[model samples]
Target: MTHIDDEPGTVSEPPRGGRGRRTALIAVAVVVVAAVAVVGALGLGGGGDEGPGAPPRAGSLVPVTRATLTERTEVDGQLGYGAEIPLPVKATGTVTWLPEAGTRAKRGDTLLRVDDRPVVLLYGSLPMYRDLGLTARAPGGAGDAPSGGGTGTGDGGTAAGGGTGAGAAGAAEGAAAPGARTADGGTGKAAAANPSASPAPTGAGTTAATALKGMDVLQFETNLAALGYTGFTVDEEFTARTADAVKRWQKSLGVPETGTVGIGDVIYSAGKVRIGRPGVRLGQAVGENALTYTGTARKVVVNASAAGASWAVRGTAVRVRLPDGTSVKGEVASVGRQATAPEGGSGEDGAGEGAATLPVTVTIRDQKSVGRLESGPVTVEYVGREVKDVLTVPVAALVALAEGGHGLETADGGFVAVKTGLFADGRVEVSGSAVRAGLKVRIPE
Candidate 1:
């Protein structure tokens, strides 16, 4: 994936090593971009080269507009629970039972039956790989997510709130922070992000009364609080009050009050999740890749270019189209951190290498408008780049300069040199001492 350089306003020259006529290639690419911009601004029927017409008749001349020029675009999207959540198995056992598809499982609920033992679900974005038993190592890690493993929601709903579990000392693990808002409308900053940042596993299976130190103890402490067992400072140090709280939580679950959390006792996740189809059948041998499922949340997801990502900030309004031809308002809820390489086909027919893309998620504002359609293809329109109060002209109006760059040919016999900035809809952002909103320019037929 290519990183956008933070370099300020540095001009980038085109690739110099290619064998083709670079100037012609660049000119062709520029024409295409200008055509798109003009088509968007003028609301033309479609885009293609319109052959040049005779010298500008009064009717053929178009005046530049002084209002805002916004690039509103409609892109295809998938309407479903944003992305699929994988339930990485930390336990090894034969599958005894699997939940029916479309079942909804909350935290602490039974997600599956392995060897007749229930695989309980825990809410948090982090995955579980080790048992939650008493140990000397802490549990926080520098990772992110709360896709609610072992579950899938088709409605495209997200795990609500901004939250994070802090790892005890350097012993934190299962850190999943997608930087989402917490339920209290607060950011989930108590997060344990460094998965490998935890203390080394040592002194396993200490007595319940032992004053333990590590992230596992810390997570065990936090899970107890989330489960409503309070009265202790949630930390890596296992004090007497912490033990009392754990024992009470165990008792509530109808298990022995051991005052110790087993690896299988509790689960972690970003929050509650809707489960999808199970990955295994009954009696299947459990391997490294055991549990997997889709999600049930209803969100419109788009794979947008870096240009589109520029407008992916939270709270941007979007128009979504369902399968029924119904249109509903949506909002940009989240944007991914890093850009990812285009997946698959890199050949002539595929998303070529070198260029990267950003993933954007939009949530439907009027939920009732969507009705029962949970998963399917949809379209969304985003309000893109806006150039305000500037002189603009149809891309077809541009006349290549013999001296280099581009210029605007006046209706009569003169040409004006202009500096261009943004390109949107079919209009190019142009400014010059002489250019105004009402100036006339020639257009190709």
Candidate 2:
């Protein structure tokens, strides 16, 4: 101590063994303190303020609900009757004897009268000759000819010269001279004897003397019934009784009482009669009027544009939305057998004033309801397949997570990843570990 030099702010090193022991003791004390602190926190039940095993704070959330879903398709259409017909002029002539615009006719009753022109004789002599010549040239033509007769026999017995005799001789001569007559007055007597023979009728009973009877009259009566008239019977023959009934109906309706219902009358009664050209006028030739009358319009038909027709189907349920927003339900009754574009216009082009559309018929199942809005515009809808019992969540409850995904706050103040499913009526279905039945969730404010 007497020889030690005093150095400023300097100290000498201690013994190595003693220094190591002191450091170890300090490390042990620090470890024991940390363990005690951990044990205290766990025993405190993981309370807030850095307690061990405590869950993180989370936003509010909602649990997903399960529901059934149905897929639907929408369309547009109109309400109409199941049957319709277009009355056309039965025979071409000047219009005559039109009772009224909306007259009703019984079956077999005269609907309209055409100017009774003499029966038109369509001379087929040249055509017959040509046909005969062609047949003669055919390989089997000669074989078909009767024996003991030449080409004249097959020429309807019209030959230049031939004998006139009874039985076989007359037959042979007739076969030879189809154009030529035989002597002995046999052909003349035959013609005189057959004076009662007449030409067969043609062209759908549209003749001057064509009286209505049988099926034609039945159709007429059927059409009348469809128009809501029920007084007369369809006997397929026009009778005074039918005409009387028609006249009575016409009078009741305050129309002309001519006792005859024309095509115009039928169409008008059915509610689809147009009033332009070919209308019934006074002094028009009865049965000779050029006015074309279609059949009675029993069913209402609306034509759809090509694009609309493409999506339509037979018997597809349709809803008619009215201009006033009221709606009625029905089904597609029929589609046109053929497609017609607007005359002189392309399909892609907009329809012009004169453009025609493909016809479609929508049948009303509930006539009483449809009758309330007849001839009105409408919109239609169709329903498709259904989906059942799927997990769904409210569209508003999802939160964006940090990993570019969605998450839901768990009841235990934790976060969970969920998978989503079908979306309908503003709700989305979801699935995930965090998603469970009756699980309370925290949603972000």
Best by lDDT: 1
Off by over 4 Å in 2: 1-65, 71-85, 89-282, 285-311, 336-361, 384-386, 398-401, 405-422, 429-445
TM-score of each: 0.50, 0.38
Write one digit per residue (lDDT tens) for candidate 2, span 213-250. Answer: 55545655555555456666655666666676666666
- lDDT of model 1, residue 25: 39
Which candidate gets the maximum TM-score versus the true structure? 1
Displacement of residue 88 (Cα, Å) in model 1 is 2.6
* Per-candidate clash tally: 68, 50
Off by over 4 Å in 1: 1-42, 45-67, 125-209, 285-288, 294-296, 303-317, 329-369, 389-445
Query: How does each model score on lDDT?
Result: 0.59, 0.44
